[model samples]
Target: MRVLITGATGYVGQAVAVALAGAGHEVHALTRDPGSDRARALEDFGVRPLRGRLADRAELSGMLAGADAVVHTAFDPHDPVGADRALFGALADVGGRRHLVYTTGCSVYGEHAHAVLTPRTPVDGGNLRARLEAELRSAGLPHTVLRPGMVHGGDARSSIVGDWFREARSSGPVHRGRRDKVWSWIHVEDLARAYTAVLRAPEEHDGRAYLLADARPVAPLAVVEAAARAAGRTDALAFAPVEDEKPVYRVFDRDEVIDSSAARDALGWTPQESDVLAALPASFRQWSAART
Candidate 1:
């Protein structure tokens, strides 16, 4: 299949491109810079980069012309509603497209009173981005929405784990908003495989949404301590009230325990990295290496 992926230069996008290409599929990666090292790295994996930004509607539509499927992982975090509609409309214009896989976050479930969240959970008023993307799936566009958990691992220097490592290095003790705010995590490699599995089996996944995540939720402080240890620091982590105006104090304040049983049963998507805490050290090493 000829798959066109948006945000192909980003942390998640690069992984997805590699996963698709590794599975013997033709991958067209959308990137603003085809000359960058990231884009060059993708070429090593046989992914051809389509030089264009998300804002370029004409370029995006042209790239979609010959695509057998689309996996949208790019969006404006601040203006997700607009970005989602724009991208979906462009993909819908491409006639006879086989599948449209939209990547959303588990935050769409919001703060569920229940400890576990399934695809069947009634969505609380959550992130606008996931909300609008879910709507696109319901609008009859042959779409499959994948709500992945807090993605980590790989050369993800901008992730929460990376932040903890950086802060622990310079600031000593890492301050967090809520020590109890626990959430499910997905390693980038595993998340990429999930995308590949769904794309390969669109006959079963089309017009459906799945929550992809780990087996359990982990506390933020535990992850922070892991980052600190990975960075070779022994500073004691501190927690502040959520009402505190400090930036670090409000870093994280949500609890998400996403369930992926449906995706596993339907698309045979099984995530291998169940112990994200154990993997944090290696993840931080990759992130640290990437930045330096």
Candidate 2:
């Protein structure tokens, strides 16, 4: 299969691109600058970088023309919803039978509290992520949605877990809310494998959504303490929660325990690194090495 991945240089997309290429698919990475160092790095792994941006309909359509499937992982933090709306429109304009593997987050379920989230869990339709999800479902395309939990691992500098390490080295690791609030976490490599599994058998995954996460849910403080231990700064642990007024920050205050049984049972996907606490020490080392 020929696959084109948007945001191929991003944290998740890069992993998915390499995984797809290793899985024996011809993978093309969409980028605004095909000659970038990140794009060149992908070449070392057999991925071809193609010049394109989400805002350019002609470029996106042209790229889609050659791909047997597309994994949409590109996101603009400044205007995520707007950028995706444009990308989805381009996909619709291309009008092919090609399969789409769309990336979304568990934030769509928005403050599920103590409830275990599944693919069938009711989404907070008013949330921006949920609205974008609904738009994709109604787009009349053969697509699969992947709602991954808080992703950790790989290029730790760009991961939220890495942020904890950075913070730990400075003032301290900061928790946004109660220290006991739980979060579902997944290793980046495991998340990439899920994308590979879905693409390998698109028929089985079409029109379905899967929540991807590890088997366990962990608290923020546990992850912070692990980072401190990894940094050999356990004696300097000074983590504390600070109140934030933003509605988006509320996600940190709530429990986001996700059930990924549907993905595991259907796609034969199993997380290789299920424990974030166990992985943080090595992850911190990698993050520290990257800085030096």
Number of the top lDDT candidate: 2
Model 2 sits at a Cα RMSD from the real structure of: 1.5
What's the lDDT for all of these models? 0.78, 0.86
Judged by TM-score, which candidate is best?
2
- Give every collision pair in model 2: none
- Backbone clashes under 3 angstroms, per model: 0, 0
For candidate 1, the TM-score is 0.91
Q: Which TM-score value belongs to model 2?
A: 0.95
Residue pair clashes in candidate 1: none
Residue lDDT tens for model 1, 192-276: 9988998777877777778888787788777877778888887577765567664333336656677788988898777898887
Q: Which ten residues in a row have the lowest lDDT in candidate 1?
A: 245-254
